[model samples]
Target: MSGKSSLKDDIYAAVLDDIIEGIYKQNEIITEKQLIAKYGVSKSPIRDALIELCKEGVLISHPRYGYEVVRINEREIRDVVDFRILIETGCFRVAAPTFTKEDIEELKNFTLNECWWNGKDELPALKHWENNMRFHLKLISYSGNDYCYRMVENSTGLLTRAYAQRFWDQRDNRAWNIDIEGHLCIIRCMEEGRFDLAEQELKKDIASFLDIICPNYARAVDL
Candidate 1:
């Protein structure tokens, strides 16, 4: 890649992470100068990165000054959880019966407490969000539905923003171990071939997360 392209990619990755980590609040303005300094790149890279984010709806463009971070409100939050609930609950219905013990174990591999923290033992919201995504995607993929996995994966941008917006400090204050426990419950139910219980646990876990992140977000996920 050209230097400019390389810089743009780096800036994009860094800024995207910040956006999804909720480090930059909604409607916040970020200037190229700030990013140029932050990423130690030229103005061109920063401009390109902002433009790219705007394309992804992660940022809104401003003429010459800077870009504005879009707000991910409770409605958006509700949509994400409800989406997960709908897909995941259905996934368990189909995937649970076919799941072997090995499948459950595979899903469990990522839910370890070690997955929640960074090398410094700090619980970063972005890292945890990634882990959460992996868990959900792994479960869906194991369900043997190609379309389902792709559908959920396509929501990564929006989902990451929603997660970062609320979960930035949640892991710091709350115990992510509880989240692992919830996943374990779902896995156990699936392994036991109790699809009903697995579905219930999956819904409850999504609802619980919604309650924590955005209580104003409608908690009901209609089947």
Candidate 2:
């Protein structure tokens, strides 16, 4: 990558991390001057990063004021959740039937691997989320469709940011443990060639976030 592009990407990630970590609250104004001073970079990469964030709907650009962090509404959250279900389970249906013994074993390792954590009870929310993404992406990869994989990847990333913003202070290890079980159940259904059942389990896994999104939006299975 070109040095300018690399700097832009790095600044983009740094700004995104700040947003996710609550350093930049919703609707907070961020100016290029502030980012330039903070990162000790020039205006070009700062503008590039801010422009990229604006394109992603993560920020709103004001002509003279600066960029404002976009506040995600409940409706937008539900839309993202539904989009994830459509791509992930849809891809799972196409992929599950083609999973080999090796594929199944590798998936099992995602949840069952001890190296990724000290123990389930002691797992960090960040690490648990990583495993969750790994399992879902791995299953989707078997579909052999690059576009579907990218869709799931991007949707999951948005959800991850939302998740951190909502549940950062409410770390419940038990809930994450339940999600791991959900992952295992989907894998079991895939192993048995029960594509329909596997899809249901995958939907439930994706819908687990509904608990955080809203009380009205319960699990997908209930809907």
Candidate 3:
């Protein structure tokens, strides 16, 4: 990437980080002037970053007012969760038998608390979410299908941002409740050459996301 392009990406990530970290709340207006001042950049890169965010559905553009952070609803969250189940479980079924001992070991590492925060100083919730995403993406990658990997990556990104936006104040509580033990069960099933059981555990892991987001809501899949 060119220096200018790299700068734009950096600006984009910084703004998105603010949004996911709850520095920018849902439906809040963000202006180019504010970002330019914060990043100490010219208007060109700032506008480019805002446009990219708008295209990703993270922000909506207003003619003269500025950009507004978009709020994710329960229905949309369910749709993303359902899509995750479809893709993640399907990929695991194809990829589980192909996993080697090394892959299994790496997956097990994600279950460790320190693996998510070895050197990073990010918020606990963001670190936890990053670990969850890495685990799932790494597992799906064994499918040897780039298309499937990209799909899971994008959907998981949406879910992560949604979780932060929805429960910013309760992030720590929700992050701690994630099903890390479920990941262990999946890994064990794979280690035992029980791909069938592993696939089932994968489905449950994806559905468990709903419990974290909406404690009282009924999941579409019966655990």
lDDT of 1 by residue, 1-223 (tens): 3588888898888888777656787678988888877777678878888888899888888887789988777777677777878987887688666777787776776566434434424545466556667777777887788998888897767866766665554444544322566777887877777879888988887777665566544534432
Q: Give the poorly placed runs of model 3, Cα more than 4 Å off.
A: 1-3, 109-123, 170-176, 217-223
lDDT of each: 0.73, 0.78, 0.80
In the range 51-159, model 2's lDDT, one tens digit per residue, is 9999998999998999998877666778888888988878777776678989888878765773254566677665667677887787788889999989888887677
Residue by residue across 1-223, what tens digits does model 3's lDDT show? Answer: 3478898999999888898889998889999999888878788989999999999999999988999999987778888999989988887777766789888877777556534543443447666677778878878888899999999888976888888886675444544435467777998998898889888888988887888776555544344
Find the 10 residues in a row with the least total lDDT in model 2: 169-178
Task: Write the candidate numbers in order of decreasing lDDT.
Answer: 3, 2, 1
Top-lDDT candidate index: 3
Q: Looking at model 1, how many pairs of residues clash?
A: 0
Off-target runs (Cα >4 Å) in candidate 2 are 114-116, 168-178, 217-223
Root-mean-square deviation (CA) per prediction: 4.0, 3.3, 3.5
